[model samples]
Target: MIFAVVGPSGAGKDTLLSGALAARPDLRLVRRVITRPTKAGGEDFEGVTEAEFQTRLAQGAFALTWDAHGLRYAIPHDQINGPQDVVFNGSRAALPEAVRVFPDLRVIVVTAPDAVLAARLAARGRETVSDIATRLSRAAFTLPDGIAATTVVNDSTAAEGISRLLAALQPVRA
Candidate 1:
């Protein structure tokens, strides 16, 4: 089973994912390859330069790739096509392609209110007020039609959010 964990920025996708991975050791988390440097530091990703990313893409090292925020993101071929119940932080813009690639892929959508999102994004300090404003504006984006997605509203405490996430992913235990 492949579960694509997706959400708007500051929805606590990483925090919840980290907690879920720690709680469920059997799940495989795909560490993405990004065009950003490792020091950019949000998620644990394989930071590569744009040239290297293009080269790897040309070499068919990825099963999936997408560009967002002016950066390239990829999921290694072996990582997705392999036999394992995998999970990864995925993007909304890439979900349609991802669905085509992994037909059985499940979409887990994590989300929160605008006020909560604003607060969290502010706390991160990675974005300026204007940048966060833009993010919040785009946060209301709707998922592609016909995609079966499970929405988990991560509006409360971390423990509550993790519990909700764990419940949503419980079928993976099978």
Candidate 2:
């Protein structure tokens, strides 16, 4: 099964995903292809120029694709198949498309209080004051109807958040 992990900015989705992967050796993590610079840093992703991204899209190289924050993101078709359970960071805006493409996909939605969300984004130092405000404006993003999702709130220590994420992922593996 493939898991689409999604959350608003500052929800610590990437951090929790990393910790879960570290603790669960049997799980597979699929890195994404994105149109942002590789060094922009938050999660592990392949950064390509818009031209290269378009080329790949035209070649039908992606199993799932979406646009967010003015950037294009994709999951390569070759990476989702295997014996082990696979998880990829995904966007909520494209969950409907994701459901259509990977019908059995499980969604893990990470969330945090608005205050926590605001603090984390400011701490990242990657976004300007205006940008952080823009992100916090959408902190209450909800999943589209018809999709069942397990929600994990990460307002505590990273360890606690990881534990919660692992618990959510384990039942699906069974």
Candidate 3:
């Protein structure tokens, strides 16, 4: 099964997933190919130039791809073909395409209060104040109708959030 974790920026998706993976050795985390510099951190990703990204896209390297915040991101085909239960950071807007690719996909939406999100983003120091504000102002996205999804609030400690996520994923974990 493929579990796609989607949420607003700074909502602790990566932190939550990291903790979950550490505790659940059976879960596999998929590394994404991103157009951001390697120094910029959040999730573990393979950073590449825009030109390189375009070249790989043309070469059919990605199973799913999308653009957000002026950068492009992709999931390689091999990452989703494995037998293990895989999880990766994903975009809500791309869920349909992801579902089409992995029919048994489950979406895990990690969310937090607006203030918590803002504070977390500010602490990351990745984006400018203006950029953080823009991200905070962006409206929430709803999952496409009929798609299976679970919402886990990560407003507190990482352990709490990971527990919630793990509980939600319990039924599907093999």
Estimate every model's Cα lDDT from 0 to 1. Answer: 0.92, 0.92, 0.88
Candidate 1 lDDT trough over 10 residues, lowest sum: 77-86
RMSD to true structure for each model, in Å? 1.7, 1.4, 1.9
Error of 2 at 159 (Å): 0.5
Better of 2 and 3 by lDDT: 2
TM-scores, all models, native as reference? 0.95, 0.95, 0.92
Name model 1 segments beyond 4 Å from true.
81-83, 172-174
Evaluated at residue 34, the lDDT of candidate 3 is 94
- lDDT by residue (42-136, candidate 2, tens digit) is 78889999999999999999998999988999999888978999999999999999999999899999999989998999988888989988998
| Stretches > 4 Å off in candidate 2 | 172-174
TM-score of 2: 0.95
Candidate 1, residue 97: lDDT: 98
Residue-level lDDT tens digits of model 3 in 6-85: 99998998888988999899999999999988888767899999999999999999999999878999999887776688
Tens digits of per-residue lDDT, candidate 1, 1-174, equal: 899999999999999999988888888899999999999888899999999998999998998999999999999987765666799899999999999999989999999999999999999999999999999998887889989888999999999999999888878554
